[model samples]
Target: MNIKIPLPASGGLLLSYKCTAACRHCMYACSAKWKADWISEEDLVNILSQLAGKILPSPYGPDNIGLSHGLHFTGGEPFLNFELLCNALEIASGFDIPSVFVETNCFWCTNDETTREKLLTLRGKGLKGIMISVNPFYLEYVPFERTERAVRIGTELFGYNAIVYQVEYYRRFKALGIQDKVSFDKYLQLENRTDFARNTEFFIMGRAPYRLTEELADLYPRYPAGSLVHMPCSPPFLRDWHNHFDNYGNFIPGFCGGITLGDCRELNDLLKNGIDLEEYPVLAYLIQDDMLGLLQFTVDRGYMVNGDGYYSKCHLCVDLRKHLNAVDGFKELKPDGFYSNLA
Candidate 1:
């Protein structure tokens, strides 16, 4: 069946791929290794214009009340480009788009007053909320204090609008007396368990599959490419609830990172006419026959599968996409840096 993802009801824009931290679980593989490539004002406006009224009611609001707008500003970290982020919030406001928020790792939350000032500035620019990331991965780079301060002030300012991505991790870190950053190894040591990912919403894709094979081994065992299950990724690909448009103008369907459905620059036409599988050969194969289709396609292009096997079908898909991105130059495998930065 041809794949045509429904218009997104909830999503964010990745302002850039450059992040302060190179987290092991980063699905986008965002890190300092990336160049300083923030999204242009033109592209941002174009994307927001197309998405302004297409969104459905937001699930985050009460009875789908006043906060139904589902647009958000994100990036390797939206705070990295404070001016651009402010502009983004203002632009969304001009479009009468409410409930707009920003996602961050809180690397910029150096002091309480400073953080409060920035939050207030954004809020004044029509910002609705904020989501501060709190996980073992983020703990590896950002101090626990920064995240703590951001959440505290955000809650004070936005009330229930302040969100902690997995409040469980926030509570866990506090209970363990983690005031500063902890190394990944030490985090595991303190937790007294290796299967921490099992407790969180971990996806075995992108940098996770490459960096966390050992940590996630017991929970998701590896299987040979030939022996692994072959099912279409449509379930995740077709997910219309949340999708993202990247600074590179790639329409990232759901969380299938590095896979672009079509260019967001041409979003209006794509949405109106629907997508043609032939235009996205890699997406076509994944939608039609899953990794096996990509596996066969890559093999024909002189690629060899690792004898050691893979953690999951998504893992296999990433590896195959990496190979294709390097050799075949599939337009759908966008932001060539996404694959290169994995190493």
Candidate 2:
């Protein structure tokens, strides 16, 4: 099947990679120990401005027009720098983005009075939605009541639809009794639960490969070599309508994590004139969805496996990218954390 690249309709700004609590499942391997600066107001303004330009105006009436463009702010903990997070929301609002959301671990919520005050302030600043991260990994450091409190506050301020509870994949698998025999199709079947919780899959990148893989080995059902290639990319890259911008205003394509596609400044140009994925050799191989082919390609490029078999296709893909990232041109494709022992 030919890979289809879709136009972006929504974007996520990774406010910063610094977090108050370090979750083992974090794809970015963020923690208090990680040294990264918060995104500047100027950078946020530039990114939102460029994003606003690419958003095609809706032909429908005013009520339906703003829905064409959406924006969300996330991070190791967006609340770590509350001011910056608020500033980002303000900017997105200024651009008339239909939806402005924020994802947080809710570690900052101390009490009902405090949480209500903070969330109400954010709501007044144009925050439209709130996604509270809740799972076993987060529960380790964050109290359940904190998440509950944040949820309550969010519902009161943004209404029920605006409040979302994001549960990690492993937790969902365990909840649905599919952990022992994993299947994506099975996952899809149970995705329609009426509960506020939304099942989110773990990307076998960052700390997950090292920190959580072995412990959950029995939960991961492996695919035969090259079979994953034919398996459709989740969110189907064609419908990957979202783009992620990091602290430096670098655009990370939704289909290609860690890899920086271009700067946010070039977003409008790239969107107007779509990119040729094949131009980036690794990305080209990636979109083909052939894990065995990708492995062979890596081997041909002087990579040797460490005798450790991967838990899944993503496991193998991440390992391969770690080696490819060392090559001069591909170095910036993925972040350095993917190649390090952040755990």
Predicted candidate 1 versus true structure: per-residue lDDT over 182-238, tens digit per residue: 988789888857557646777778888888766656666788998764655645676
Please give, for residues 1-343, the per-residue lDDT of candidate 2 as tens digits: 2333455676678888788877766766677775667888888888888777444433432122222236678877899888887788788778876667777888888799988888888888877667777655675567666776777777777674344445354345346554222232333446552231334545765566667655456556555445554555565433445667788656776734566665666666765565466666666666555556777878888988655466556556666777777654573365565355345
Q: Model 1: number of clashes?
A: 0
Candidate with top lDDT is 1
- Looking at candidate 2, what is the lDDT of residue 333? 67
Q: Please list all clashing residue pairs in model 1, or write none if there are none.
A: none
Which residue runs of candidate 1 sit more than 4 Å off their true CA positions? Answer: 1-3, 60-69, 215-220, 232-235
Which ten contiguous residues of candidate 1 have the minimum total lDDT? 60-69
Quote each prediction's TM-score.
Answer: 0.93, 0.78
